[model samples]
Target chain A: MAELTYRDAVIRGIAQEMTRDPDVVFIGEDIGKAGGVFKATVGLYDQFGPVRVRDTPISEQAILGAAMGAAMTGLKPIAEIMFSDFIAVCFDYIANEFPKSRYMSNGQVKCPLVVRTGNGGGARFGAQHSQSVENWCMMIPGLKVVAPSSPRDVIGLMAAAVRDPDPVIFFEHKSLYATKGEVPDGEIVDTLGSAKIVRPGKDATILALALMVPRALAAAEKLKSEHGIDCEVIDVRSLVPLDTKTILGSLARTHRLFTVEENPRLCGWGAELVSIAADEAFYDLDGPPVRITTPHIPLPAADLLEDIALPSVERIAERVQRSLQS
Target chain B: MAKLEDRAPAPKGSLNDDIGEEKRLALYRTQVVIREAEQRAYDLFLQNLVKGTSHLSLGQEAVAAGFAGAMRPGDLSFCTYRGHAHTLARGVPIVQVLGELMGRDIGLMRGKGGSMHLTSVEHGVMGSYAIIGAHLPIACGAAWRAQYKGAKDVSVCFFGDGTTNIGAFHEALNFAAVWKLPVVFVCENNLYMEYTPISDVTAVKHPAADRAASYGLPRIVIDGNDADVVYRAAIEAYDKARAGGGPSLIECMTYRYSGHSRADPAKYRPEGELERWKERDPIKLYRERLRAFGVGEDAILRIDAEVKREVDEATEQCKAAAPPALDILTTDVYADGGFAWRN
Candidate 1:
C-alpha cells in the first residue's frame, strides 16, 4: 500500500485508465502541460503524451461536446470542467446532450465518457468557484454520479466511471485534494452504486459524501468518545445508483438516521436519502431523521463564516447527541 | 427588380466537369429521392398521419445530396432538426424515416427519437439535434477521434444560418481549427432563422462565410439550389479535410419552401418570396441541366417515376406499422439495455 494524496490519486486514476485502453483520452483547459488549474491532473501530459492528454481552449461547451462526439464515435473521453460551479456555462451538454443521447437515439448512440470537475468549498474561491453541484447531475436521468471521499476511493471509483457504459459526472472535491490516505498498489477498480460503511456502530447511522465524509467520521468519533453516542458513519459515495439497501438496512438496525450534506439545505442530496428512508423504512425509525447541511446562501469566502455555514464536527455531534437523547 | 431566378444563375461555364456523368446522375438521383420523400412526408403531415411536428427540407435538397454524395461510406454526418433530407441522403431507408416520423416501431429510433432526433448510426447519420448549433462541436469531436486514430474519414456538420450566432458555433469552429481536425462545417444559409429573416438579426451579409476569416478559414458561399455547384464545393472541402488541411466552412445559399416547423403556415414570409425561390428550385434546375447534358427524357422520367413509386410504397408501409411496445419506454436509456438506476 502507498500513501497518496487525493490530488495525486486523480493523476494516477487517469493514467491507469489511459494506459489500459488506447481509446481513453483526456481533455480540459491547461491539462496538457500546465497540469490543470488545480494541478489535480499533473504528470498526465508527460505520461500519456499530447494526443491522449489534450488541452482545450477555455470553452466548456466545446470540451464536453468534443468529449460526447468522440465518445459517440469511438474514443472514451474524460473531459474536465475546471470548477463544478462552471457547469452552468455548459449545462446544455450535461442536461440535454450527453444524458439524452442514448435515449433519444434509442440505443444507437452511446456517450460512455466521464466529466470530472473540481467540486465543493473551503478554498475561498468565492461563490462561483466552490459549489457542490453533485445534486445537479444526480437529478438528471441518464447520468451516473459519484464523489470519492478518500484517495483509494478516488482511484477505484475513477476506474468504475471510465468503464461504465454511460455518461458519469465525477465530482472531485477541491478541499479534499491535499488530504492523504492509503491506496492499494495494483489496479483499483470499484463498483458504482455501492456505499461503504467506514465506521460501524450500534447507536445511530450517519450518512455523508465527499468532503463531508471526513467531517462526519470526525463527528462520529467525537460522539462516541465525548457524548457517549456511538454513530455509524457511512460514506454515501454514489448518488444516482445509491446503495439504499445498505442505508435502509442500517436504519432498520439503528432505528435512527442523520445526513451530513455539503450542498445547500434546499433540495440537497440528503433530502432524497431522507425521503427514501421515510418511504421504505418508515416504521424502523424511532424519530424524525435529521439533516445537517450548509445553509441556503452563497458560500462566504471568510474562513470563520464559511466554517460556521458548513456543518462542523461540533454541530454534527451536538445535533446527533441531542436528537438521539430526545 | 432583378428576378430572383436571374440572381446567381448557374455559372455560364463548365458544369462540374470533374465529377463524372455516373456520379452526377447519382447526385441527381439523391436530390430527387430527397425531394420526392419530403413531398410525401408533407402530404402525410397534412393528413395528420405523421403526428407531432416535422421540419421538411422542401427546397433544400441539393445541400444534403451534394455533401452526402461527396462523403465516403464511413464518413459521419451531424445535422439539425431540419434533417429528414440529410438522414435520407446518408442512405437510411425511406420507410424507416417515415416510420420514425409516424412514431412506429419500425422507426429509426423505434419511435423513441421522434422527428427531431433522427439517428441511424449504421448509416453514419450520427444524430439530428433539435437544439440549434449543438452539433457543431460534436462534429468537431468526431473529427478529433478520426485524427487521434489516424483515420481519413471526415465529419460533416450541417446547420441553419441562425446557428452562426450561437456560442457553440464559434467555439466549435475555433476548436476544430486549433486542433486541425478533419471536419467540414456547412451552413445552409436559407435566409431565415425559424420565422425571422437572417439579415434582421445577423451582423454580416453571409452569416457563416463572413465569420470564416476569424478562424483562419477561407470564406465560401455558393448557390445551394444548384447541385453541381454544391457538389463541386463539397468535393473540394472534403478533399482538403481528408488531406489534413484542417476544417473548411462553406455557406450554401438555399431557401426552405415550408415554415420552420409543421405548426406554422409560413404567413410570416413576404409576398412573392416563396414564389421567387421556387423559380430557382433545386429539382427544377437539376432536371433542366440533365436535359441540356443529353440525358434522354425517357431515362429522367423513369428515375422520377421510380422515386415517386418508392416513396408511395414507404408511405403505405409506415402507415401500417404499429407504434413501439410499451416496454420500449424504459429501454435504451443506458447501454445495459435497461433504465434502472437502483437495484
Candidate 2:
C-alpha cells in the first residue's frame, strides 16, 4: 500500500492507464508541461510527451466535443474542463451531444470519454468556481456522474471511469486535494455506481458525497461521542447509478436518515436521496428525513461568509440529533 | 444585367492522367443523381409523402459530389443539416436515404436520424448536425485519431459561411492547427447564411482563407460550382492532410438554388441574382463539358435514365416500408438494459 494525496492518486490512475493502453490520452488547458492548474497532472508530460497528454486552447466546447469524437474513433480520451463551473460553457456537448450520439445513432457509436473537473467551495474561489453542479449532470441519461472523497476511491474511480464504455463526469473536490489516504498496492478497482458504507452504525444513515463526506464523517463522530447516537456514513461514489441498495439497506436498519451536501438545498442531490427513500422505503423511516446543505445563494469569497454559507460538521451533527429526536 | 455575387467560378482545369474519361463521367453522373434526388425529395415533400423538414442542396451539388468522390474510403466527414447531397455523394443507398426521410424502419440510423441527421458510419459519415458549426471539433478529433493511430485516412467537415462566426469553428480550426490533425474544413459559402447576405454579416474578404494566417494553414477560395475545381482542391488537401501536413480550409463560392428550408422561396435574393446563377447551373454546365470531352448523348441519356430509375424505385420502396416498432422506443437509450437516471 502507498500513502498519496487525492490529487496524486488521480495522476497515478491516469498515468497507469496511459502506460497500459496506448490509445488512452489526456487533453486539457495547461495539462501538458504546466502540469495542470492544480498540478494533478504533474510528471505526466515528461512521461507521455505532447501527443498523449496535450495542452489545449481555452475552449471547453472544443475539448469536450473533441473528446467525444476521439472516443467514438477508438481513443479513450480523458478531457479536463479545468473547473466544473466552465461545464456550462460546453453544456450542449455534455447534456445534448454526448448522450444523444449513442441513443440517436441506434447503438452505432460508443462515447468512451471522461471529463474531469474541480468542484465545491470552501477555497474562497467565489461563486463561479465554487459551485457544485452534480445535480445538473446527474439528470443526463447516457452520461455517468461520479465524485470520490478519498485517495483510494479516487484512484479506483478514475481508472474505472477511463475503462468505462460510455461518458463519465468525474467531479474532483478542490478542498480535498491534500487529504492523504492509503491506496492498496497493485490494482484496486471499485464499481462506478455503487455507494460504500464508510461507517456502519444501526442508529442513523448519513448519505454524503465528495466534500460533504468528510463533514458527515466528522458529524458522525460527534454524534457517537457526545449524543450517544450511532450514525452510518454512506459515501455516494456515483450519483447517476446511485447505490440505492446500500442507502435503503442502511435506512432499513437505522430508520432515520440525514442527507448532507455542499450544493444548494433546493432541488439538491439530497432531495433526490429523500425522494428515493420516501418512494421505496417509506414505512422504514422513523421521522422525516433531514437535509443539511448550503442555501441557494452565490458562494461568497470571504472566509467567514463562506463558512457560514457552506455545510459544516457541527450543522450536520445538530441535524442528526434533530432527526433522531423528531 | 447582374445582381449579388455576379462573378463566375473558374472553368474546369486541364485534366490530369489521374482523372480519366471514366472518372469524369462518373463524377458528372453523381452530380446529376444528387440534383435529381434532391428535386424528387422536394417533390415528395410537396405531395406529403416525406415528413419533417429538409434543407436542400439544389445548386451546390458539385461541391458535395466533387469532394465525396475525391476522398478515399474509410475517411470520415461531418456536415451540416443540408447534407442530403453529401450523403448521396458519400454513396449511401438511395433506398435507405428515402426510407429514412419517410421514417421507415429500414432507414439509415434506423429512421431515428431523418433528413437532417442522416448517418452512415460504414460509409465514413459521422453525422450531420442540426446545429451550425457543431461538427467541426468532432471532425478534428477524428483527424487526431487518424494521426495518433498511424492511419493514412483524413477527416472532412462541411459547413456554411455563418458557421465561421460560431465559437466552435474558431476552436476546431485552432485545435487542428495546434495538434497538426489531418482535417479539411470545407466552407460551402453559398452567398447567404439563410436570409442574411454574407456582406452584411461577415467582415472578411474570404471567410475560410482569412483564418489560415492565424492557424498557419494553407487555405484557398475556390469555385465550388465547378466540379473539376472542387475535386482538384479536395484531392490536394486530402493528400496533404494524410501526409501529416495538418488541416486546410477550402471556401467554395457557390449559391443555393432553393430556400434555406422547404418552405423558403428565397424572395430575399436581389434582382436578377437567381436568374444569373440559373444560367450557370452545375448540372447543365457539367453536361455540356461532358459532351465537349466526347461522352455521347446516348451515354448521357442512359446515365440519366439509370439515376431516374434509382430514385423511382427508392421512392416506391420507401412508400411501402413499415414504421419503427413500438418496442424500439424503449430500447437504445443505453447499449445495455440499464434505465436512464431520471430525477
Which ranges of candidate 1 are over 4 A from the true structure? B1-16
- Model 1 Cα lDDT, one tens digit per residue, B1-343: 1112344444334445577668778888889899998888889988898889889898999999989988898999998999999999999999999999999999999999988999999999999999898999999999999999999999999999999999999999999999999999999989899888999999999999899999999888888888878887888888899999999999999999988888878898999989999998998898887777667789788888888899999999998998899999999877898887876
| Alpha-carbon lDDT, every model | 0.91, 0.87
Judge the docking of candidate 2 as incorrect, acceptable, medium or high. Answer: medium
Clashes of each: 0, 0
Q: Each candidate's TM vs. the true structure?
A: 0.97, 0.96
Total clashes for model 1: 0
List candidate 2 stretches off by more than 4 Å: B1-18, B337-343
For residue B74, model 1's alpha carbon misses the true position, in angstroms, by 0.3
lDDT of 2 by residue, B138-169 (tens): 88888888988999998999999888888899
With a 3 Å backbone cut-off (N, CA, C), the pairs that clash in candidate 2 are none
User: Could you give the C-alpha RMSD of every candidate to the true structure, in order shown?
Assistant: 2.3, 2.8
Cα lDDT tens digits for candidate 2, A1-326: 88999999988988878988999999999999899999899999999998899999998888988898899899999999898999999998888788778766767777888999999898999999999988889888888899999999998898888888888999999999989999898876777888999999989999999989999999999999998899999998899777788889999999988889899877888898899899999999988988888998989999999999988999999888976866
Judging by TM-score against the true structure, name the best candidate. Answer: 1
